[model samples]
Structures are given as structure tokens and as C-alpha cells.
Target chain A: MKKDKIINRRDFIQTGIRTGIGAGLGIIGFGLISRSVEGKTIWQLDPAKCVQCGNCATECVLQASAVKCIHVTDMCGYCDLCSGFFRPGALELTTGAENKLCPTGAIVRTYVEEPYFEYRIIEELCNGCGKCVQNCGAFGNGSLQLQVRQDLCVNCNQCAIARSCPAEAYSRVEPETAYLLKGFEELKITD
Target chain B: MQQSIKHIKERYIHLTTIIIGCCIFLFWLFYNPVHNFTEAVPGLDNRPPRSSSLGSEVIIGEHFTFFGNAPDPSLTGRWPNFRGADFDNIAKDNVELIDSWPATGPEIMWEKDLGEGHAGVAIYEGRVYVLDYDERKERDILRCFSLVDGTELWRRGYSVPVKRNHGMSRTIPAVDGEFVLTMGPRCHVMCCDATSGEFLWGMDLVKDQKAEEPLWYTGQCPIIDNGVAVLAIGGNALLMGIDCTTGEIVWQTPNPDSLRMSHSSVVPMTIAGKKMYVYNALGGLCGVSAEESDKGKILWTIKDFTPNVIVPSPVYVGDNRIFVTAGYGAGSALVQINKSGGSFSARTLQIYKPSEGMASEQQTPLFKDGHVFNIQTKDAGTTRNQFVCCNPDDFRNILWTSSTTERFGLGPYIIADDKFYIMNDEGELTIARFSTSTFEVLDKAQVIEGDDSWAPMAIADGRLIFRDSKKMVCVDMRANE
Candidate 1:
């Protein structure tokens, strides 16, 4: 019978070479399971579950509030008139960035040797805008605060400046040893 | 009938040549790019032979062997990623230590308490990772201790509250054997699960590559290699890689030439035989090429020795040279490289600044035996942060410094036996003894009663780990036990 039609045309050419190697291995396994699953997960931020609402400075897309303002020189009080660097009247008392009250000049003041001065806080030009922790908690001694500098805080899960914090003053923390030294027992030096 | 019309014309030419040879072998295996380069570089193409059933209780390439002598395997001591391990803070193995330590020295062996940030420590095998910053739970942990009694063991991370400027999660994780990556200062990354801490995978390399992060945010540290990982993450794709078991990007490296991720750490290097990677990009020092499927290519770039705030971590010493340093004063550069024909060039043999002596800003100098060891700072009182020991060919004239008392020293210096422990920043610890001219303190102590300990410190097997913004110690130099 013509050799059974050449063995049915050699089993239809071996089932079309095993369906072309199973459709080229299902399109390289669906392009490697869709590139493994895109960018995995690392978004972090739990500073005790953050609620400090300022929406991380208008919900950061970066206009300067990578959530800044941080100074705990042992909760600072090495004061000389540092309500986080002046601006109630600013009539004179030098160390200028325009009578600094941090609107984005980000306080710097350095001196630390003669009756102390060391202000420091350029947290990328802080826009966490608490007005230098409200003039360093009204007339210095509070040592400016508003944490969340987790290296420029991008832990963002819902923090668009803590959802526009009016004074919800953000929360969510757990960064192992989360910063909290607001005036180191009044700048310790008790002999 | 003529054999039934010649068997229906050979069954219609064997079913149209087996359906056009299965549609041209499924369109040449989906338009082949070398079959998508072994599915985008997964160990390249089947390589699983080196197991030999634990040959003689294995210990293979001897990454610093230590078993009965006790200098190498104490639950697997790890400086895990960045500068520790071959990134080059040097710690390939060998300990036996204790040339001195007894005046209240070397017997602490345990401390725990840690949580502020500067994030460094990634020991592995027996645990002891770190990332800190947990003000009550604002979150940023990743912890995991137990290098032998430091305890803790599992932490993972979240939250993110911070406030202290001189303190805040820095970035340094990348372990290997089964994953334990991490990057997060702001670049995210994550990975997890080396034994059970579990997180599995993560990404956010600066909002999916719009990438900028680094005024103090992403301190680089995330290299991996072979199993993939990479990540310098400076948009237009400065470097990506991924897929250390399915995180999956597997090849990005195309900054076109934008660069940007330099607080330092991504070094790898190989040169003449070709492996490459090297880094330090905001405007200068590159090298890429890790073996072309294209994850990175750069090869070489210099850019006038750029520095505005680079933060040390490039040291390659011997075999084409390379050394870099930075801080507010911005000084130190060596370079060299060369290659020719296939491409690579570099140049710039020495630059010096900070008054021309040693000047690093956060540990990453030590080259060893041929001499390099650094730690200078204090800008202009003629060098006060001390602890030098130069001569890498005309970065010139210092040979030795370190009478101790200089203050703010940035942590990192741990060589055992040839001595040199150092740790100052107000937590003290000294020990010195690296001769070529002088630096022989021999004993100091203070092991973290607290105060800016600056991070860096992780000996292995014979154990010594260190840390401070709160706590994380582990002394036990071995020899008396």
C-alpha cells in the first residue's frame, strides 16, 4: 500500500518537530515569567506607622521636602539665641541666611567652641516646613525636630508629606534606633 | 491506480514540509538574540557541577580558611556586602589575634542595644545584619544578630522615622548564599531570606528609575554578581542587573552617560582577564563591562577627578592601580588603568588635597603590605583626625600618624595579627601595630559605652564585630579560649 504511505509521511514529520519545540518553550517561558515579576518589593517605612500627616511635604515628587529638619545635639540648648537660628525680630545677632527661620535656606550656623553654636540642618534644604520646629519650639531649647530623614525618606507607602500634615506631625517609626534626643537632658554637662 | 496517485503525492509533500518546519522553528526561537542571551544571564547556560558531595567536608576555594585553628568559621562572620568582603576593606580570612588587650580590653563579647543608623554590618552565615533607626517603631530595621551571642536574629524592616542628621540609615546588605540583599536609605532594593527572615523581593530604585537619591540617601552598597543583583540605580539606567532568583530585570546599565550614584561601593574589578564593574559616578570614574549581554558597558571614564562629596570606596591597589577619597575638602585620587586595543584608559596618578596627606571621610582606604592605610581629616590645623601611613607612590610623605586624640574619626580599620583594630569617634578601642614606620598603640578599650561609634568593624570567625549609635558589639579575639 505504498508502504502505508511512507509511514504516514513519517508521522507527519515527527509531529512537526514536536510542535516546534513546544512553541519555542512557550515563548521562552512567557519571557521568563514576565521578567521575574517586575521590580519585586523594597519600599520600606514604618516609623512606628507614620501619621505625621504633612503628606511628607505635599506628597513628595521632590520639591525639596524629602522630609527634613533634624538636630538633636543631645536635644540642643547650647543656645546663644537659637530658636533654630532666629527670625522673631532678627534685629542683629549675625549668622545670616537672611535672618534664617528655614523656609528653604536650611540653617547651618557652626562655631561649637566658644559658648557653643553648631546649628546644622541642611537636610537637602528641608521643606518639611515646620518653620524650624516652630522657631525651635519657641525661643530655642527644643533643638529643632521633625524626624523622617531615613536617608531622605522614600519609604513612602502613603506618605505624600504624611498626607498634608497640618500638625498631624507624622508617625510610623522603627528604624532600629529611631532618632529622639530633643535636648539631651538640657544639653548635659552637670558637674 | 498508480499506487493511489503516488500515495497522494507523498501526502501532500509531507504535510507541507511539516508545517513549514514548525513555522521556522517557532520563528527561530522567538527571533533569537542568542536565545535572549541564555534567558538574560542566569548563570549563563546551565552550570551546576561543583558540589562533589561535600568533597572532604568542603571549604572549597578557601576564602580565608579557618577551622581547627579558629580564625575563619565562627558561624560565618560577615562584613557581607560593600567594602567588607572583596569589595576590598579586606577580610579574606585568618585571625588568631590578641597581640594585646587586657587592660579592660577584648573581653566584652556581647552588647546588642543598637538602632540609630549609618547602616553597615552584614556578616552572614551565622547572622548579624544591620540597618537600624527604630525610634519606638518609626521603622527601618533589617537587623538580625547572633554572630555568637549577640542574639536578636530576625528583624526585617519598615516604618522610617528619622531626625538625627549625622545619623540615619546608610545602606549595606548584599549577602549571597541564598539572598539577603537590601539597599534602602532611599533606593529600596530589599531581597531577604538567607535563612528565614523572609521578605523575598523589592525594588524602588528611586521611583522606578526617575533616579536621583543621593545627597545622603542611597549609599550605593548592593552588588551581588553571578546570581545577579548589581544596582547603582541612577536613571536612564546607570546599572540594574536584578534576578538573584527572580527579582528580574537582569540587565539595564544604560545611563546613556548620565551616571550619578556615588556615596561609593560597587567595585568588583578584574582588568586584563576582563570582569570590570568599578564605580564612583556622579560625573567621573566608571568602568562597567562585566561581560557584555549589556548590563553595563562604560569601560572607562575620568572626568577631571570630580568630587563635591564622593565619600570614599574605590581602592583597587596593584594591577593597574586606583584609589579615591573625598570629604568636604575633597582630595585624593590615583587612577592609572590603561588596557589599549580593546579600550580603557584612565590616567591621573596622584592628586592629593586636605594639605597633601591622608584624607578619607568614612572609612575605605587600607591597601596593605605595599602600604596605604588612611584616616586624616580635621581640615587645616595641619591634620588632626590622624592615623595615616601613606606611600602609594607620591600621594606622598606621611608613613605614620595616630598619637590617638583627634576626635571625630569615622570608624573602619580591622586587621588581625598584624594588628590595627582602631575604632574611635568617642567609643574608643584602638590597638595599632602596623609598622613601616610607626602607629603602635597596642591597647585602648572603651568598646561602645555609647556615642557616634561610626559603624564599620566586622572581623570574622574569631569574631570582633562593632557598632554604636546605640549598641552592637562582639569582641572575643580568640587565643585565650
Candidate 2:
């Protein structure tokens, strides 16, 4: 009777130790599996495909659309009747915020020379609304277009701006080569 | 009976102790859940060493200096500069590369962890040069490595803080025979010893010209021609050519008309037997007379075809035709250049949206045998993006298209041995054998496990160098013995 009791006590101790070990392992396994799921996403953009639709302003989870306007000055006409800067059929051709086609008044116009004027864009104020792009493409040289500024882009899933683009302009670009300019060349220019 | 009672009592005491120990362990495991004491301990994170000093010992080798031996006259396969020998994305002779890669594609010989940058590789004299961001030092680096073993030979760069816009720096280095020229993320031009990696001279175009930096940063790769480093400073000054040997300002393309610099680089062209510099500036596309002392002659300007963004390098196929494309519904255009009386005029032949054909972001279209091949983005009519081929004269009809797997591709196409090598955004290296009818995918492999393998590829002495934002890889595509 005494020997039987001793053997039973030993077995009980062993079982308790085994149960504790199994529980510990279960906790560790759960932690590791959760970590693996978190390592999957790196957001990027494709410049060649981005369509400048107004959804970039509203669809983005952030307060501002990551998509902004970029200007290729080489492609600019430097015209006095600037389509990218002023609203179509504006009452007057002046540098008034209300007369600008861009809803946020992002484009700044400056006198470059006698017949030419330099137009620059303040990208942060741009909402990718395509107002300036529409005006630029229609009237003056098409120098302004909506580009998903990768730096500002959160790289969201189903990029809200891309889905809403009317021209279907948003395409996935290699983030490395994402920025597209209007008239940049690859060769050395000799003066 | 007394002895038995004593033994039972001892057994009960031992059992009680065992149960108490178990309770203590469970309490330790569950108590103070907020602390995570075990994980907070040292030697547990399993991260790579974070010491900033680790990069200092990563010795760039001894081959950075250039002694200028008239580069071998008969050297057939040297990709001497940014795009290639002529700033065109065309390889010299027909090389017979392997038509197909395995399911995962060609074997990756080696890969090294690199800092961020969009700068591509420059291969010359069996060596490879690249510009990359070094986060540890907070500076951009110009690193040269041996093409054979992927070993660093030398690196030269000063500290520049990275601005928070998707990281900084994107210009590729231009490698000529005796010099390597680089444009920093902020439009600073640095001419370095091609072999030694020593800083020769630096010029800040941003401050000198009072020009605003581009949206992302300066991306125009410095151009080296006839011992001069030519750069496009987008201010009132249109273009500037600096003497590579002495770092002196050789000539500045006068901005008498006040044209700003576009993101495009300068392209050298020979039209009607007259050499001219084809530059796309902010105001318009202008062709400056290469032989003129003034260098500011505007040959022709295409104001109507200007798109919002022009990122792709212009590809000049014949003496008379030029192709330009961009994203954002801004389509592709083919221009016909007519030269007479020592001046030229360009007329647009066709303009089609991305739905009709290929649109390029950063890579110049590959022109060969009267056919143009490029990776096109999507548009209104088409739901899919692809690699396409078409006639250069008419951008209208598509000759063929790649597989439609919803995968997007960017950057330049590389040709080797009658085959085209394309790296997609997801890091798949696809080798296609070119025929007029179709792009036959011989093989495809995921060479790197990262995003944005968009830098233009460099191949020299039978090695192919490619990169993503985080790493650069050198693959041996040569035939195995």
C-alpha cells in the first residue's frame, strides 16, 4: 500500500510539470504566429498609371490626399493665357485666388521674361482635384498633371485616389522610379 | 503503525510544496502583463547590429581612381555611362543571352544590402559604380564595386540630411573614361575620380542659379561629354557645361529668354549631319546648336504636347524621329524632325493615351530594328498595364503585349544578346527573346525580395546589376561552363 502511494505521488508531479510546459509553448506559438502576419505590407505607387480623379481628396483616410500636382517646366508654354493657373473663362486674368483653377490656389505665377511667365505649384496645397490639369491640358501647354507624391502618399490599400481617378491616370509605378517629370532629359546638355 | 503515519505525513508535506511551486510559476507568467519583462531583456530582439560605426569598416576598395588609359578602342561590352555608350538604351552588338530563366528565373550570383536611392549603375572598364543613400551617416554615397565579385572598391560622399519625402536622392551617376559625374538629390554636381572615388569638385546648382528644387529632388543624371560635365539648372539659366578636368564653369547656356530646367537630362543628337543638344526644359523642348558658342539656340518647341509630368528619357530612334511618353492620362507622342537650312522643325505624328500602348515613367523606350518596346501603364480604354511593342513613326497600333497578370513594371529595358531583360516592380527579372510578332518570355525569377526594382539595369563583363529601394543585386547571366 505504501509503495503504491509513493508511485502515484511521483506520477502526479510529472503530470503537473508537463501541463505547465505545454501551456508555456502555446503562448509562445501564438505570439510568433501573430508576428508573421504583421510583416507583409510595404506601400508603393506607379506613376505611369495614376488617373487624376477628384477621389484622392475624399477617399484618402488621411486628411490630405497623398497625390499632388507636379510641373514639368520644360513642357510649359510660358503663355500669358495660362490654362493651368487661371480658371477657364475667369472674369479677369489676374493672380487672384478666386480666379485660379486649382481649388486651393496652389499655382504661383511670376514674370520670367518679357513674353514668358514662370508658373510654380505648391504641392502641399494640391488636392489632386485635376482642376489645374484640366485647364492646362485645354488652354495653355499641358504642364501640370496630378502625380501621387510617394513621399506624401500613405500607400493605402486600393489607393483611394487611384480608384477614383476619372482619366484612370493612377498606375502602380516602381517607387524607385515613381517621380515623372515633363521634359527632363538623360543626356548632358552642352551650352 | 507509528512509522507508517510518519511516512505519510512526510509525503503530504512534499506534495504540498510541489503544488505551491506550480502556483508561483503560473503567477509569474500571468502577473504584470503590461511590463513584458521577458521581451524587454537584452539579447532578445534578434535585430541586425545597429552600430553606426559598422559602415566605416565597410572599406571601399582601391580601384576608385581613373588613370585615363585611352579606354580600349576595341572594348566591345563596356556600358561606359548612365544609359549606355550614346545615352541611348541600346547595347552595341547582338549578344546571345539565355532566352529563358527558370520558374524563379536566372541565378542570382550575389546581393548586398544597400541604402535608399533611385540611382542606377554605371559600368565601365569591368567596374560598376552606383550612388546610394547611407542612412547611418545621413549622406548620399557614390560607391564603386568590382563587377566580378560584387565587392566594394571605394566610396566618396559628404553628409546630407534626408528630407522626409519618400526619402531623398534619385540621380544615376554618369561614367566616362576618365571621370564619373554625379548629381546629388539637391542638384549638387560632384565630379569624382572614376577609379579612386575621390571627390574632385562639387557645384551647387540649386543655390548658384536660385532655382527651386524639383518635387522629389534633382534626378537628372550628370552628363559627361568631351571632357565636360553638363547639367540643367532649372532657373533663369537653361543649361551649364563645366570643365570636368578643372571643375571650372566652361559655358552656361544663357537663359536670356529665362527658361527653367525641366526634370529631363540633356540628350545629344546628330541631325542632318549637324550635332545638337536636345534638352527638355521647363518652358519647352529646345534643341541647342552643339557647334555654336552661344549654345542657346531654340530649334523647335512643342508647346501643345506638354503633359503634366515628363519623367522618361527621350529616345531618338532615327535622325528624324523622337518618342516621348508620361503617365496621368498624358499619352505617348511621336514627333517628326525636319531639318533644313541648319535648323529643324518638329511635327507631331501621333498622340495616343496609355490605353492604346506603352507609357514609361523613368525608363527610355528600347528602340531596335525600327520597333520600340516599353512597359506601358493603364488608361481609360485598357484595364491592364503591360510591356508593349509598336512602330516608332505611328504610336497608334500595338504590335504585341506581355502577359496580363495585373503586375506593373517601370524603369528602362536592357538588351543583351538579342534578348531583353525587364525587372518588374515586384522584383521579378523577366528575360524575353525579341521577335517582331511577340515578346517571348524565356524565363522569370524573383531575384530580390523587395519592392520597386525600378532603377535602370547595368550589365558589364557578363554580369547584370539591379536594385530595389533597400538592396542592390548583381546577377551572373553568362553561360555556365
Stretches off by above 4 angstroms in model 2 are A1-191, B1-76, B93-95, B102-105, B292-297, B356-358
Q: How does model 1 score on DockQ?
A: 0.01
Model 2 TM-score (B-chain only) = 0.80
Q: lDDT of each model, Cα atoms only?
A: 0.67, 0.67
- Candidate 1 residue-wise lDDT, B226-262, digit = tens: 7788877767687778887788886777777786787
For candidate 1, the per-residue lDDT at B430 reads 81
**Mind giving the per-residue lDDT tens digits that candidate 2 earns over B1-481?**
9999999999999999998998999999888976732222222213233221212322222123333323333434667666787776666644445666644556677787887656788888766777777788766677777666666777777666555333355777888858998887766677887866676787666566666566456667778878888777767567777888899887776665556655577888877666777776655566666665555455666654565456676778785877877654566777777888856788877777766766665677888888888777534245344787887756677777776763455645777777888888778887778676886887777788887677788777667888887788887776642
Question: For residue B429, what is the lDDT in candidate 2?
Answer: 82
Stretches of candidate 1 above 4 Å error?
A1-143, A146-183, A186-191, B1-90, B94-268, B272-283, B286-299, B302-307, B315-342, B345-448, B458-474, B477-481
Number of the top DockQ candidate: 2
Docking tier of model 1: it is incorrect
The global Cα lDDT (0 to 1) of model 2 is 0.67
